[model samples]
Target: MTERPNMETRTILRVIVCDNDIRKIVLPLKPQTVDSLLEQLEEKLGLQYKFTLQFEDPDFNNSLVNLTDIADLPDKPTLKIVSLVTTPTPSTADTEILSVASDDPCHSLRTAWPETFEIPNFPVDVEYRLRQGNLQYMRDQTYLQLSGELKHEILEKLSETIYSYKAYPNKEDFEAVAAALIKKHPCLTQPGSSKGWNGWYDSLRWKMGNYRSKLRRAGCLEVSINGGKRRGQQPQRNVKRPKRFEINFLPNFPDGEDEASMESKRKEMVEEMKKRRLNSALIAQNMNSTFALRRKELIEKEPAVKNTVERWPALFTNGQKSNVNARRTAVLHGLPLLLGEDPTDFYKTCFDCDSNEDMLDTAIGIMTVIPEDSPTVPYSLHLDATTTAIILEGTVVVDNLENVPQAMCLLFGLIYALNLEYPAALKSTFDFLQRVILSLGHKSLKPKIQSLKKSPNAVMFFHG
Candidate 1:
């Protein structure tokens, strides 16, 4: 028998030759030596100078391998070609000039350079490009420290860029501006820095917002008051102000009238009152007694009685009396009445469990076993056991019970019942309870209560 070669499969390798000139070459999986690959590169690229091949790892850490050694290349292999030639170094004066230019603020902006320096025009249109460069140059470390006129100039240039482009200073624009500022002035991002990027970004956004608002307001004013103006036309400078009118405080006064004129005026007033059907005694009675009783009835029936009282405070308070506590109690009592149950009986059955700890524990246990289909085996075993380890034993569990799921379910049951009998009270109590749960940080109870809110049993709990 003769040994066979696996010719059924082949691997293609992507090779990158990096040097003064970079090139990419692909090679097939064949039993070729390393020297053969180099020869192919030399022939293809027309290399006249001798070069050494190295793997393109960081700092060229891989050892130099023998050219005759078989190369075990992976699917994509990157190789470098280095020429054996010495390059000239810059003179000390040239190095010093380069260093100074990098530190100079005006290096990036030729227009802002010394007045004696003349910049030759390039073939490309560079006005917008130069403006962008100057905008970035404003963030340089040296420029960051400059104040007064220079700072104002930077802001003016930024405003001009935004106006020219009509770019809104949104989150993306803010991030781009902040990133450029941080890259050029890293100290602005550091803690305790007086010139932080946050304040700078906020100031720029506020200026843009104010400028946009002023333009909008001006356009609206022109449209409403002056019907706007023609394009490219200056507004009239000496526009006349509208004339002001004086109001007569005593238009119907009879101060300088004779006896006949006064008598005629009195008769005319009586005739006008009669035509309007005005009765002074009835008006006085309604204002003193009937209106007060009707307002009290409205307050009692209104669900958001708190807001009603806030709007018309005189409804609950007079100069000599305040009924704040009385109204709050009425609302509290009316909440349970909305469920078609006696308020006293409901409170006695539910909230009155505070004094009886054993009954409260039993109620909690019953709530845990609700829905009937819940896995009761483990809970039953725990309940049957007398060992302290298996049983829950603590007074704080009942006393410190905040807005948990079970309590939320009970509250939802009340709300659903109120929804059926008295929808007005249901809406008010729902909003109030939501605020209470949010303030108590019991957000986890929300989903469970919402799920229960859709249950049919919530409307009539005795049926469940």
Candidate 2:
């Protein structure tokens, strides 16, 4: 029998998995388009009803990226497959340096903001002018009224920051913020109005809501999810969010992982935990590598906490508990000065004002918590300047943190690592830091950080 010459056009590839259990297929012809390739994959992978497709690219250090264009496929490329429904949404410090996205594409947007009206800090030049503006207002009764350009620039950064937390802002959410803004700066109050900030409050309330409405109408899913469903409506409660700052909360299975591959890693972790001479390194690696699968169990099955702990006991260990994703710390050291607005400096710059010496030295009663579970523990986040230790409800858990940034970073990390929610007061601050600066866990920033990615010089910062 003679083979047809047309058969030479065929292509072969191996689905990314362990070498021992690789799934390989030869295509009769190279798929001419991305959709065609996806169709072929869907038909061949027996149990996969729906899937996401990624391929190794030498262009991205052999890291996998979504297969957007079939022509982008390299000859005989390896493909990583995962169910589309299970793309896990969402870091570590120095032992693993997060590479910057310098090689990734960057784009710009017209404006952005933080979720709250408590602006972290204005641009350095803006701050200076604001100070000057305040001094002048002392003699005359005028708030630090900004020029049209200055206001837009300021609000642009604020919009990016706000979008990180939520696309919508209501009166209850931002009114107090306006009051506090004028209170602190004094220069920012409008003299004509009895309350002093009617105009600013209106700007926040209407502007943020309008932005989402416009985007939703324009079918901008980035602001409104999927740009489908009803636009600009409040979501029913119980939308699943990262319990903490979980980076790999709902992530795609790792580059070459599926049920079997991940299960094997899980077993290996269990076996390693059994060993008297535990391999901490190997256990950590496996723990991190299996995050997507762990989340899949938690998200889809909604398993009892006890059942999960028994199956993966090692995961409940203190070491593993503290080892949650450090994605928010991703390239944190590389974070730009951001128009002289250092994101890390929020705590120091936060209360450095006309307050008495005691207020500046120690910020008492800043945070409080009443757990849903019984035995309500006191919720207090107090900073003792002299000892430089953080006291949470009468006990000192963290000590000698030395400075505010280190303490703040550790506190933020602990919140995520422990799967704790942000204190209601500081929720916006946490979201901005998580979604904007450091750029850790969670899917769909909703940066695009206000961002270093969003613009040449704008980043959001908030302090509680």
Candidate 3:
């Protein structure tokens, strides 16, 4: 299937405040209509600057509205606003609708907080106390009321789940928890069957809707996960080989002037220069480097590689030496070897990209590259804020045989960078480190590395 390009779309205007205490605008506005909006915005911003509009709609194909197209917006004019986020009117539909018994418990809790607590005369006694006639002795009897305990409990649980998702934001994990809750505690999880409160079941539904909405609004929410079981059938395995387009060069290049051209010309050269076969082309999209070369290297030293394999047969096992060898192989093959140039920078890129796999990989590679080093490796590698640098104190786990060589190569690069001051060496070490981390999963390694790099005492860890 042909991939759809990002579409142009509009979103609700959200006002943001920057560190400079200046108000800034983020958009999900229409291409043409937003131009008019920006006219109003520039007047509001009181500055002459270019702006970008990102598409906020998840369902839409393209969602960017560039503000560069706008002509002259008034410098400073009366800013008439349709939506000002004040304390919302108490009677607004959202407020009124949310205040009802059918609304989310969190919303309800906010609206009718301490409903019972505010009334001092109301009974705080349990059912057992009431049955024992404990209140009979009271000279002034007050109306007995049950606690909103059930409502509060359900709300707390739902809030916990949503919060957990926000922190980690894994759809599969979130859905699994949601599903488990429903299966095990149907009263609380089901739409309208919870016991105790007047509209207990309805409240659950509201919580579900509310939580889902909050997550969706956050923008990183997964649509498939929100749809429950209605999501389509599981995607089929992608076994079809990507179609390779051939380009025929001019006749003069038949023998190919250079070794590179000659290699291209030799149809039989395909056999000699074995192409690195990616697990899937998609893997290439995020991989910092190619596994093809690494695989090729393994194939090349069938004899020497075989000897090493035989001598250190344990390298194939889960051992430090094995891990080192595996990492070396990965580096030789061309997988990235570093966490990134600057942990913070790469992190922001990843976060801004919203975890777009391809962009994230590129960002990670860019951010982790040792900056002082150039030519050998370029500086200013991209990364996001969430990127971390791990300081492995003891042993590191090797997930596969391939990781062994890759780890060894990474260790060597790290050692080389440690004693040396070459910018290129640092870049190479960072690249090597990143590839090693990538094998486990990008999310796992980013945090550790990021923390160390950001610290003022970043030098101490080298010896540790």
Candidate 4:
């Protein structure tokens, strides 16, 4: 009997890698998504996967085409694969310029040739990246050393002067060069050097160094000099240098006037206060406050406690001592005794007086988590229902809350602010609050706070 021929059917698929160029890759099986393919490669090859992908026609024979551009494909997957060979197309950076270190003036001019020159007319900004990736970014000194167009411009100004060399004299040598130049041109004064070659050289050096330092700080100039010497490298030609000079351009806020400017400014102050309050509260709650007592004589006589309940009906106005939100919430929460005070007024007497600075100073001493030598001192924050709302409004800005005198001041402030409308009477409550802050040292709360502060990332509040 004759043997029967067997027939089999298979779906043909091809893998193409998107890289400097596209190349076909033999994928054992078509992956459902790119992520699965990377997982398979990582597991099989024990390599961290990172690659761009494309698909090829089932036929697999031709100049490698970009499979990613095909209209029918779904979204690209995250899988990376290696095994794909590409005919990497060299970009403009592939062009090479051979150099023979010659003292010829032409060679000097060539040194000034920027690694890149922008084509202003081009629809898009175009730059020439040098083939030598490790070439140092040339400095202004290097460019000035070259007698190029820029050099010519400098030389023209000094032609009448006896100074022949266009090079900038070193600061130590500048006076000598200026004296010699001034003798030849009676019109040229020694002070001219301040704005002439010497001055330009010094200014350029300073600016370039500043610019390059900025680039390095930002990690933009990662390409090392000569591959890894870690020495000074010039910025690639035409690359914009990073800005380094600092000048305050914005209008300065007056001292102590947390006067709400725009809504944005108000929001910022509110948020800052809330964080301080929270930190203070947490510190206060954990203290051994049983021994804590207010300095009795320091307490001022109390005024008639205003009934704030009816005050909720009043519209927010300037010069009011209470914040609108504080009063409204107090009334809503049935805390009628605390009503009628404006919360936003910040202070009825002196606006700039920091009522909480003393508390913050105490917090710095009480906070053991913070090194006594730490540059930033612990700060005390005062928050009420409105202020607490400000702190938890978005995110906690303060980082070292555990080092605070009372970490839960924020919580207490929030509770009072949220559950009761008018803040507890300021004078008596602040004294009481101080005692509460001292209570944070109580043994029961210390560990809980330590655990909170020591957590790798302890966030006081999460933003919605």
> Which candidate achieves the best TM-score against the true structure?
2
Ranking by lDDT: 2, 1, 3, 4
Q: Model 1, range 272-339, lDDT digits (tens) per residue? A: 33445433222221222222223223333444867654433323322213223322323333333343
Give the winner by lDDT: 2 or 4. Answer: 2
Stretches of candidate 4 above 4 Å error? Answer: 1-30, 38-49, 55-61, 69-202, 209-464
Q: How many steric clashes does model 1 contain?
A: 0
Sort all candidates by TM-score, best to worst.
Answer: 2, 4, 1, 3
Worst lDDT 10-window in candidate 2:
101-110
In candidate 2, how many Å is residue 34 off?
51
Candidate 1 Cα outliers beyond 4 Å, as residue runs: 1-143, 184-196, 213-464
lDDT of each: 0.34, 0.51, 0.30, 0.26
What would the TM-score be for candidate 1 when compared with the true structure?
0.17
Per-residue lDDT of candidate 3, residues 321-379 (tens digit): 11223223323323222333323222111222342343332222122212222221111
RMSD of 3: 24.7
Residues 1-464, model 4: lDDT tens digits: 97543323111232222111122233445455546655654454333224444332223212122334424333332221323221111110111111222332211111111111111111121111111111222321111122254333333333212111212223433344334332332222223365444643443345434443443343421211112233674533332211222111111122222223323332333343345232221111111010001101011222223422121111121211223332222222221112222222121111123243322222111111222332221111111211221122223323344312233354455545557332333332233233322333233433434343332111211100
Q: 317-435, model 2: which lDDT tens digit per residue?
A: 65543222222222221242232232221221112222323224332212121223322110111222332344343344576554444656777766667676664534445555676
Q: TM-scores for all candidates?
A: 0.17, 0.34, 0.16, 0.18
